[model samples]
Target: MSLTKFIEEKEVRNLIDNYVDKPKFDLCAEIKANPQTKSYALVGTAFDYLMRFHFEYKYSIIDNCHWVAHNSLVYLLIDNFKLGIEPVKPIAFLTEMNFKDIYNDSILDVKDLQEKLKEKNDYKGRQIFKVINLILNAEKEYSNFLKSGNLTDGVIKATIDLAKIDVIYRRKHYPNDLGEYKEGNIQDLKQLYKIIPDFSKKKDSNILLNPTFDKASQLVGGADCDIIIDETLLDIKTTKSLRFTRKYFRQLIGYAILADISVNIKKPKNLGIYYSRFAKQFVFNSDIVYETDEYEILKDEFKKKANKIYG
Candidate 1:
């Protein structure tokens, strides 16, 4: 399919309707003629999603904003945290800090604390705390402003806090000339929370949010699927624009393939990309994706790449 054809919303929706029912064939479990091929290979899907990684490590056409991944992890952590899963180890660090009196003299200063943490060699803990602190500050400021009926000071303070944290974190982590992109991501994270409501609310039995799927049965790999509602699989992306790149679409398709092989559901009925920044959503035509030769090649490449990397 041409790039322009893929972007047609109406045509895409029509093709997606085919996934609403149980698939006529087990696309995920279908073994190829070759003996080496396996059902729904995840390494292949990952290679397809991140084709640049195949060429060279630390390379991608997609914007590699450091904060984006951190924000994504935090969002995922928040989802699972609300599901009554005890936050443990690495994730526990995010919620283990207290921000009540961290600020001195109304100046949210953490420089000295940051230095202390560094001296103690608790780098990961410190980094996790900074991200969580920003989130906590945002929530507190937003809620308190709503309660007090004073809209101006509270919201502005929250926005400033977010920007300040982003600048500080990026200086250490990114250390490049992508200042505008980093700043944009901070704003995106803030808007993402407001756009998607009911963060703490649980859904129906069929709808599993942020559940880790173990593909150990297939012996390929395992990963977390963002949201699986009935027969549909959806992944969230918090970006400034609504454009869906080929790699992004392929990533979701790979997850659907994994879901087909591993998850209890027979086959995913539909696939969606939720752009959290503007609350925009794009549904791809999964039926076309499953049967295409391109997907087959992607799977083959993934298997080859996985063997190369693992060996």
Candidate 2:
């Protein structure tokens, strides 16, 4: 789950004010810095070829440097579709040619990403294209949901909207699949409405949250986009929540402050929460429900409550 910048900043600031004399670091920055050091690197000539140019190709010249050129062409097809939300014309081709992602189902793991490059397989060649086709089908369905074949507001009114919750993890994408420490976020969203920004199969939504900080400086929370959506700082949280909780709210509160303070924007009028339930594919994707920040309160109240929890 995600940790809000607001909560992190408060904790770090408290530590400096109460725990340390000189105050070595902000709690937000210290917490954020823990996982920044590890990024996966690619290896070998074959692997390097894939990451640089070959991977760029939908399908290119076979590894043997033969004239098949399947990798480059196929890769281009996937990239074109991925780069845009539109249904690629050649999606039908995917049904015939079967290829698989070199990496397994655990796409989140860096090892899995690397395994793609380290290994080679003819059987897996066209699998990714087929998968992209399935994603397109989902997008089509969501689109039809958006339009009611007429000007009736029914399609949109019944729709759910969402913002991407980008949790800044030093090394991991999230503490856990549903984004651990995100319980507070659920509380907020359930108060608002359900929104699903993603429809394409495995089409992930992202929001930029990581702010590069100077050593020994306060972890200022603002970033480029946070300054834009001014009325409210939305964190579209996807987590397990039949009801709300405290930890999740702090996360949203933290994000709210970061969004406002970092960009020099005014605090939003409303802080919303988004709740999406999960299935066992190790992924959370369904026409799930969500809502906005229901349990609003003063930061001091959060601080007093948080202090007790941490203690």
Candidate 3:
């Protein structure tokens, strides 16, 4: 179970019920989606990638290298070959000839990818292509496309395509199990570009993207949160609804507990949800969740429950 799954347990819900008071906050102005927006999940995931790209472009922060999807997908491809599972469609094509051998030899770790991205002056259009090449083990296939500098539409499409890999990786599904490829709506990118500037204005803030809680994450199988700016832990949501429900509140609280127990560089002083579609963040101080003295008690309870379930 992950942090999300752990929090959803009946016992965990009851624990939250006894502790967390309902948060009261005003909703932000909503930005209506285009009529052509069909894939909400795709857009959400792609926008996440876009936001990371925006951060890297603007602040020169290289932090998403530890993304589980990329690392997990790499492991799955190698494991499938070892098990002699009959690879299908895209996987078969990707692994045909000596590609599997090439993949095993050239698999890049998080550090390697981070260093490579750091060396590039421009990571905006090329990030998704590098990820795709890494996943498919077909650097040659996308080499020309990466060189042509015609990356606008291609980048958006690649972002959505790469987002699809997350589902497969999370479910441990075969690569060929990926559904039909969806074309990315340019309007999604347009919306993202417009709202991103407001969010990125925190120029001097310390930013950590897709941060894990070290051994705390391992306690509940795995958990990696969105961006944490300075002392605030924020989860990016691209949903149209502005409702800050109990579940959402509990998620932020769960992340706080994880951060508290872990040896992370920064501990969150506040927790927030950045509704990307609305381009507004609803932030609440950690004190709002629990009193200073109460937090230690809560953390101990959380660890006990997590150990009971995950151990």
Pick by lDDT: which candidate is best?
A: 3
Q: What is the C-alpha RMSD of each candidate to the true structure, in Å?
A: 16.4, 19.4, 9.1
Better of 2 and 3 by TM-score: 3
lDDT at 309, model 2? 46
lDDT of 2: 0.28
Worst 10 residues of 3 by lDDT: 83-92
Once fitted onto the true fold, the runs of candidate 3 whose alpha carbons sit more than 4 angstroms away are 32-35, 83-151, 175-181, 184-186, 200-202, 290-292
TM-score of each: 0.40, 0.29, 0.75
lDDT of 1 by residue, 46-76 (tens): 1122221111122212221122233433432
Per-residue lDDT of candidate 3, residues 1-311 (tens digit) = 68888888988887876777767877757575442477787678767766665565556444543444454445443553331222222231233312223434454443444454456536331333344454453223233344553336555655665566776566664344232454445667656657664555566657787888888888888888888777888898888788898788888888887887789645688899988777788888887655755667777888899889866
Poorly placed runs, candidate 2 (over 4 Å): 1-127, 149-230, 234-244, 261-266, 274-311
Clashes of 2: 47
Off-target runs (Cα >4 Å) in candidate 1 are 1-205, 216-223, 261-266, 291-301
Sort order, TM-score high to low: 3, 1, 2
Error of 2 at 22 (Å): 27
Candidate 2 per-residue lDDT over residues 265-298, each given as its tens digit: 4445554443323211111111111122322333
